[model samples]
Target chain A: MSKTPLPDDKAMLDDIAAIVEKTGCERKNLIPVLQNIQDRFLYLSEDAIKILSGHFGLSSCEIYGVATFYNQFRFNPPGKHQVKICLGTACHVKGGDIILENFERKLKIKTGHTTEDREFSIDKVACIGCCALAPAVVIDEKTHAHMTPTKIEGIFLGYEIEKEMKIREEKKRDDKDTPA
Target chain B: MMIIISVDDKEIQAEEGTSLLKVCLDNGIYIPNLCYMEGMETPPSSCRLCFVDIDGEKNPVPSCSVKVREGMKVFTNTPRVRGLQWSAFELIMSNHRIDCGSCLSRKACPLIKISRHLKIRLKPFRVGHINSGNEDIVEDHPCLIYDITKCVRCGKCLHICEKIHGRLYLTFAGRGVDMGISFFGDSDDETIPCARCLACVKICPVSALLSYERYEHSPEGSSS
Candidate 1:
């Protein structure tokens, strides 16, 4: 069986150090430090957490405990695209849970897990502040309103085709750049 | 200084600035709570079980987060308060492993006691069970054994760990529904730094954390 690769600790530490510098490396700046690190890495890595613990004079457990108290922080690496299904009151009444289950089935990954190919990840958010557009699904910051289980396949296909076209265009650009 | 508050039409004197939940609990008044960590300055109020109706307030407020005030009128058994508490208790039990019949701590488990007090039957809710199949049991430590499935994320263990040890070796990892308490570092030989004070195990409310020896000697045939 192939072994899982370890994250580049040196690069991650550098990014964490930059965040700590920006956030002032204080115990009280824990949330901001975690937020900035997550913004840079899409999730809080073990190495980043260790660096924060050292900088803040807190144990790794302390940092991890505080981070887990909130729903915003993530520990695993996120995917290229984040798929968020709104589970707000309006959305729930409009069958948002069904839409979420369909996405989970289609992606073959549960909520809060990245796909094996790192193409997408799913999350059930409390709300996107758009109750008027009940049953909303947000993909990479783009919102799709009035979503249904049947519309999931079309959305997946659209992203797949878009990704294929982008790959082809990049290949063409590389060919033009190379010497004939 | 002492403050007077009326709870269920009974006038009670409590220490000023103390949490209403603490006053109610200390005075033999039952207000169900799962996340009220003792000596915590700011309560998380995540459990939503200690909700109480206050005079002039339209909605029931969480008693653990609110400090007592002089001459405040509080109602603990109002229909709205009971309804909200019951819903919160049911929500907490929804994801919990309800195998009390075979649990090692069946006699003294706080989850069982609190649920019994709240009159919450172990029935399934519409939210469904979160059978994630991620019940990883950690038995590396000679003294402690952590069962990930039974955890309710009360934060009591972490708080008491820091309170007693002045440093935390255990922590909650991950976020959202997948969050679970875990030990730091990868070394099996790290020799679980806990002082064996049993602070975390005693503070755990649920039977998630148990003494390894106690678990071994407990009744057999129980699912982990």
Candidate 2:
């Protein structure tokens, strides 16, 4: 992928304007409209939120408050692979704590934290409802249930495979550029 | 135009262009689902539990999000699909609070009802440092209570606030593990419109959001 950023603010703002019109600019309709916009754009940009606030005749804080109140709205960029650990009742009772601890130690990030490489973001979720298989964790939407601290290394290695391959490819390019 | 769609080994004809989810429900072909309210467009495909395998796709896609195309082969219930769905279900249930006995939507919550119907007999995972307790629940103001522990990040609450209120108030603050709802501009009572619209409460599939003065236990609910 090129180092260039995706799109400019103007394009993003225009896209938000389209959502505002389609949502009918009703007071109650703001959240869905924003959600739709966010679905298109990974996160809600400040410009988009400002446009929505102006169209809805609400303050930016009001707009931002609702956006920040739900788990689906993302203010920051997401990782390539998202890892979520269930910490609900059954899982918690069955050593879900140990699993989460393992992830934190291995990823060097706690729940609600993302690795600097942007490869992974680890989160703690409530019940995924697979209680019979307590202490489960989901990586990139693939669930790994009944996990033990021992199994975490394997899981991390699975993700690390892709990460390391990418690093090696980049290093090869740099080596070719060295002076003779 | 009527089109035929296959669920497992059975083939059924349905009106053209209806959502696979609606067709399945009409035919009594229960393709597992959550975050999809029959009447609401929140399509809330956000939950990812409605995923079903179509013939050629690499990954199982959410049935609720895709429209049924002609001659499309759909696999509703399968060993692999069930496992994937079950895994997703476990993820949501683990992160969600289990005080359903006292929740208002305990009887009506889709997640709870669907789990019983699926006869999900296993508890594969559990919670860690993020304790599930009353103290962890957020009673931030008079209008609502946000129990972060019970949330599934379905975007249903986000839709309700934006769709009905014309104001983008609260939203998911971070990505991945740090992903949870947060307040904007000091999420305080004075700042909140306190509309008490109950959109967030009504849309939540779990007990993440609740009314301020709810009392009494939840009534009997459906396992269907």
Residue B148 alpha-carbon offset, candidate 2, angstroms: 1.2
Q: Lowest-scoring 10 consecutive residues by lDDT in candidate 1 chain A?
A: A1-10
Check candidate 1 and list the clashing pairs: none
DockQ value for model 1: 0.36
Best by TM-score: 1
Candidate 2: tens digits of C-alpha lDDT, residues A1-180: 113435675677777787787777778898878888879877776567768877888767567766766777766556688888899999989988788888889889766567888788877789987888888888887889789987888887876797799899889988888845
**Clash numbers, per candidate:** 0, 78
- The TM-score measured for candidate 2 stands at 0.52
Candidate 2: residue B152 Cα off by (Å): 2.0
Off by over 4 Å in 1: A1-23, A27-45, A65-180, B139-143, B186-192, B220-224
- Which candidate leads the pack in DockQ? 1
